[model samples]
Target: MTHLFDPLTLRGVTFRNRIGVAPMCQYSAAEDARPTEWHLAHLLQRSLGGAGLVCVEATGVLPEGRITPTCLGLWNDAQESSHARLAQAIARGGAVPGIQLAHAGRKASRRPTWQRGPAEPGWEIVGPSAAAFGDYATPHALTPEEIEALPKAFADSARRAVRAGYGFVELHGAHGYLLHQFLSPLSNMRNDAWGGDFAGRSRLVLDTSDAIRAVIPDQMPLFVRLSHTDWVAGGWDTEETVALSRLLKAKGVDLISVTSGGLDHRQKIDLVPLYQVPGAEAVRQGAEIPVAAVGLITTPEEAQAVVAEGRADMVLLARAVLRNPYWPAQAAIALGRPEALVPPQYDRGWNDWGKLPVELAVAEPMPAL
Candidate 1:
């Protein structure tokens, strides 16, 4: 059985541990999308705490695609340069730096989650149709020309991420975002070639991946995050994600990070340990592609079991890492292999933790306020 701290390689990239920090957004960037001090501190701390791969949050390809005015952007040289510092910082702390390229689609033009209000002032929200996401705001439909231009924007951002020293890039196709809006039947009411059937719906993401892969060198890996199930009836489901995984695999996607929901307003999620692992397993089995299982995966033994059982190739954590960035290092002690995930900087801190109570090792307060 491969332990969570074991090194896993894909293409030319090697992750020191199977543990990865899922892209969690910090809506603190400048209006022009430059990385603030907050971005550097948040990601660099995770690396120091022993995460193998640290993925920066959803960075928009174009200004209009931003979910918030303060979201990161890679559309220009200055923005790329600013993020390069962050990438270097993460690498210096012994973690592979990655960026998730995204376009919010109809979910654009919103205030950051911290801000409670009507939509941000003077921002345009775009989606596949003129549908209202919730009772919050109205979204404008995209024209055919705009749809054609979107892929080029994504490719452009991928190039910038590579230039910024990202070892890997994940195209954000999950969470009812732009690429996802095109894939889900409930959101995409288009009768044209971009919708109606599964092939047409998946075309946008596949073509975007192909364009991005063309620019990025083969040494750098690319992954796609898929909402494996929309959690609503007659919407994007497990079967569709399996097929999408096959297409993404052919387009040079190294892994599929399986997440679910965010397409419907009425979704009832079952919050439990390893709840989303099955989706990753299905994609891995049905599509013959590697998968990264996410959602409430909090323990080393549980993460190890997911990999050992062939359910997923990697285990991604968002809230779990936020709860304890040093979870990977602590996990090493729990599994009786303290030398693996522990860096030389933290060697002194590794005192017979294996003998300590499990509750004491993981009883830290939440990082997020």
Candidate 2:
């Protein structure tokens, strides 16, 4: 049986283990959307912490696509150069560097959630329809010409990612973003070819995936993050997500990272441990593609069981990882796999751990990035 620490090979790239750091936005970028020192330190530390794959957060493909002015972007040379440094830092710390490309669509032009107030007026947001996401501004409906241009925009950003030295790329088709706006009927009320039935709804995502694949080398695995359900009646659900996964696989996507319910305010989710694993299992079985489960999987045992029991091929940790960047190493020790990746500087600390009781095995202080 595959365990959490087992290496996973997809296409020509192999992740050292089945543990990944789910992309979480820092919302701390400069006005220009370039990665700052915080990004470099945050991602590189997680790499050193022993995650097999360290994914940069949702980076915008266009300035207008950002969820906030502070989100990272890859549309310009400066941004691309900044990401190259981050990629190298992740690699140097012993993790495969990955990035998620996204467009925020109707959800754009908001203040950071921490600011806790109304968003200041900014650039117009665009989506499949002129619908507003809750109280946000009603986005302008995208024209056919603009819709046709989206794939090229995605492709261009993907090319920049390749140049930035990312070994893997995940398209953010989830979380009520632009692609999810096109996929979910709740947000997409368009009657054109870009919206209606499943085929129409899935066109933009499929086209964007194909466009990205056309530019990136076949050896570089591509992953897609999907909101497996909208958690409301008559909305996008697990079955549709499975079908979309199959289509994405046919278009050369290697894995489906299953996350759910960010498309609507009406969504009713039962938050619990492994709440989304079943969705991953359904997609993996239905689409015959590897799936990475995410959501409240905090402990080493829970993460291990997800992989070992064949529930999902991998598990991605978000808040848990942020709470403890070295969670992977601690998990490795607990699972009796002490050979897991540990930096040379930290070798003495882990060596002492074997002689000490579990409660006494404290981690050494991390060095400056």
For model 2 the local lDDT of residue 347 reads 65
User: Which candidate ranks first by TM-score, i.e. highest?
Assistant: 2
TM-score of 1: 0.93
Error of 2 at 259 (Å): 0.3
Identify the leading candidate in terms of lDDT: 2
CA lDDT for candidate 1: 0.86
lDDT of each: 0.86, 0.91
lDDT of 1 by residue, 1-369 (tens): 767778889899999888899999888998688999899989988987777899999999998788888889999999989998899888876789999999998887777788854454747778888877777577788888988988899999999999999999999999999899999999888988898899988989998999999999998899999999989889999999999899899889999999998877887788889999999999999999888999989888898899878899889989988889888777766776664444554444554544432222222232352
Estimated TM-score per prediction? 0.93, 0.95
RMSD from true fold, candidate 2: 3.0
**Residue 223 of model 2: what lDDT?**
95
Clashing pairs in 2: none
